[model samples]
Target: MFTKVMVANRGEIAIRVFRTLREMGIRSVAVYSDTDRDALFVAHADEAYSLGPGLAAETYLDVGKLIAIAREAGVEAVHPGYGFLAENAGFARALAEAGIVWIGPPPDAIDAMGSKVRSRALMDAAGVPIVPGVTEPVADVDAAREVAERIGYPVAVKASSGGGGKGFRVALTPEALPDAFEGAIREGERFFADGTVYLERYLPEPRHVEIQIVADDHGACVWLGERDCSVQRRHQKLVEETPSPVVSDDLRRRMGEASVRAATAVGYRSAGTIEYLVSGEEFFFLEMNTRIQVEHTVTEMVTGLDLVREQIRIAAGEPLSVAQDEVRPRGHAFECRINAEDAEQRFLPSPALITAYREPAGPGVRVDSGVRAGSQIPEIYDPMVAKLVVWDVDRESARRRMLRALDEYVIEGPATLIPFHRWLLRQEEFIAGGALHAELNRMADAPTPLPPADGAAPAQAAPGDEAPEPAPQAERHFTAEVNGRRFAVALRYDPPAGGGGAGAPVPAPKKRAKRSAGGAAGAGGATNEVVTPMQGTVLRTLVEVGQQVEAGAVICIVEAMKMENEVAAHQGGTVKELRVADGQGVAVGEVLAIVE
Candidate 1:
């Protein structure tokens, strides 16, 4: 076993890897950006070093800087936690060239499965079941149109080097194909620096299911089982569960075998997941995630396997200890990604300083979190604050345990998906395990009003009359300046009191609704709040107390990623007060506005 390993990432996953390393009596090193200087993982590591600024391009994604840190720390191996440079094949090769063990799959395996277009062809040659789609990159819009016509409308345009839903778009008709193709190309170019894209048959309402596979250098491999990740927004998984209620034992075995074949074809080692889309009994290949997944907690809860430790063992030239039959799943397990987002608005990011934080604790309840009470959720990275996972003898028991855990999980200074999760657990579709990828979309499209909170006080319309149809209490908005031009941003927020249960109509700019106040009352219905749209510094606030203004007026400017963004008013009202000033640091949804 290696004496020390440097975590080539930050946040919760880094801390998670550190915990496993500590348990194994291995020293751990943490790398951080300037913004994450005071991060919990940094404090927990036996050694630490600065990567660069908060900018991803200069920090986590900087492979050269990361290798330098590894060498300076004198670590025997480096573990690239999920995200950042985790799946970068070139980085893994560089690590090997530097004579440091890369605690992941071999570089060639990563390369083979790195590109979706290539991987699909490879999987087809290996006789693995794959989604029926184009085999080559689209040459032009003409080729895409031809493929779309043959495949029928509602086709998916995906980037050749895309994952995590970036550089992906869906076109429902020929007329929308041009826009979708262009959007996909633009995102691919910007994010992946590879404008190559391909077409796939779009499964509008398919369930997102995937299998976890772990292998060793000695050619031993096992499928830990499968997970259903149907609950998602914007193609990103929000909730996951093990032993999918929809997947039969026969189908699970078949999928597990297929996953093994896919890995073996590439000589894959370490931990990876083979994702698929399921519709009824038919399953189609989606893509392969070549790293430990954010949803791995649910699998670990059910299988009693430490995937990280297994990854280390595999890297240390040890054979996998468990066999296919020995890999038995105990019970149903569920994981809800506790992101710093509000479910009431639009699942907008809600990064802020957690004034108070408390994770649920008990048997069968596990929380893999990186933040504490004083931790600030930096906007430079993903908004996922933690993952709340629970296990039970059955799905119902697991659902109940998840609800209990969510209720017990306390967070202050930012709105979260806790309320929405609580409401979802009580819904008929979720309870019956009938949720699909389109479920959230259906709820979002519903034309109903959100119900009031259980103990929320009624709103006083205009500060005098008895609450005339309680409007939603103060919600937050975030802003990110893309260029020197201060573009008005529509920050993400959650739904109202009912969460996504009652199916409220998507909010419109001109629509006025009454919201009941949840806590203390304020003058003219103002509570003195201002929130950042993107992770950046507060450049200036243009509003003052008793300032009369119309709706859509600029109130402040936030400098994020070197761009200036203007914060605007949601309603035509007077500014009651300003919570922050010029040059003050802020995060997403820090409560910047209090208008009457």
Candidate 2:
């Protein structure tokens, strides 16, 4: 085994890798940006280095800087956990040329599966069923339209080099093609730096399932069952479970065998997943994640395998530990992604200070978290704070265990998906093994209970109830958070001069910053102030100064936590003063435009 390994990522996944490295008696190194300097993963690593402060392009995704740091740390292998440059073939090649071990599949395998257009052709040639779509990149909007016409209505214009629901757009009719094509291209260029896109026949309703497969350098490969990731929102999985309530034994065997074939076709090694779109009895290839998946925990729960340890061992030239027939999964497992987001508000990202935090504890409940009570959930990365996983004897029992774990989870600051998961697990459609994501749009508009306030009850007392006066010379404490950073403050009392007595009031300190019961000083309203609900960077300002607009018109788009949110006008009027420009950073309740 390698003596030292560097985790080239952050958040919960980084911590997940560190734990496995420690178990294998290997030292773990961490690279972090200034925003993540105080993050939990940084503190967990045996060694840490700084990547300065900037966007992902300048920090986590900076290949050159990362390689330099790894060389400086004298690490043997690098583990690109899930995001950032996990699938970047160039990065993998760069690391290999620098003589450092890359704990992932080969660069050629990554390249083969990096582009959807290329992968579709490869899958077709390898006898893996692929969706009916154009194998070549659609030239332009007209080209996409032509392909759509051939494929019939309800075509999907997806970015050739995209995954994780980033560069996907669906058009139900010819009239929607222009906007869909343009949006997909823009997001593709923005995220992947690839403007190429392809057309596919969109499936209205299909269950999302993916098979977990691991390969070794010694020509050994095994499939570890399948995970049903049908519970989703905006095409991103919110909940995942293994031993799918809907998958039959024969179907599992077929998918598992096909997964092994997919991995073998690419000469793949280490851990990778083959995602499929299953419609009743048939399943088509969706994409191949050439790295460890976010839901790998659920697979580990039921299979009794340490996937990261296996990945590390495989990268170290170790052979497979278990054979294909010995890869039988048992019981049931579920993973709920606990994110700092408001589910009722269209699942908007809410980056804020986690004033209080607690993980549920039980026999089978496991929490992989990267935040503490004073942790700051910044708006620069994914909004996932942690993952809550549970296992039981069966699917229904696992669902109930997940519910109990969720109820016991205490994350008090920004609104989270705990309540939403609680609601979803009990839905009739969900209980019947149906993919209930089609109802998310309608559920987003429903009224919901707000998250708890710093684990403190409401300050309002009974009609005649009153607060007891503070005793003189007693010390007190007050705390606050500014710009998603935590702080702890102590306010002590010392009686002034001589005539101090019991119940004497202490002079209040001068106010430092202006705040309100609702939020910041100048928040959005029915009239003017077009304010942002969260802190983020302005991706675009649609309305120029002096432009006339109507109420609820989208004035600009803000990018927070890698997700785009449209900031709409509070009321109808002329855009008197545009306060923000594209690429400018703004804070919560910060004004973006002034209208009259």
What tens-digit string does per-residue lDDT give for candidate 2 at 1-596?
Answer: 89999999999999999999998899999999999999999999999999998989999999999999999999999999998999999999999999999999999999999999998998888888998998999988888878999999899999989899889989999999998998889899999999999999999878899999999999998999999998887678899999888888888888888888888899999999999998877889999999999999999999999999999999999998889889878899999998877664456787777766778999899999999988888888999989999999998999899888987777655667776677678777777887676576343332122222222221332332332212223223457999998887645455332212111122222221111111121233444687886678999888899899875677888889998777777566798988999999998778888878
Alpha-carbon runs more than 4 Å astray in model 2: 444-525, 546-551, 570-574, 594-596
RMSD of each: 11.0, 9.8
Using Cα atoms with residue i matched to residue i, what is each candidate's TM-score against the true structure?
0.80, 0.86
Model 1, range 1-596, lDDT digits (tens) per residue? 89999999888899999999999999999988999998888998999999867588899899889889899889999999998889999999999999899999988888888899999999989878777788789978999999999988789999999888777899998999997898788668866788999999898778889999999978688999999998887677888999898998888888899999999999999999999988887788888989999999989998899999999989999888789889878989999887765554435455567766778999899988888888887655777888899999999999999988976777665556676677677766787896644446533322122323332222324632233322223333345677666664433344443221111112222233322222111122233343444456676677788898664556776654333445666545677868888778875457777887
lDDT of 2: 0.82
Score each candidate by Cα lDDT: 0.77, 0.82
lDDT of 1 at 17: 97
Candidate 1, residue 7: Cα displacement in angstroms equals: 0.4
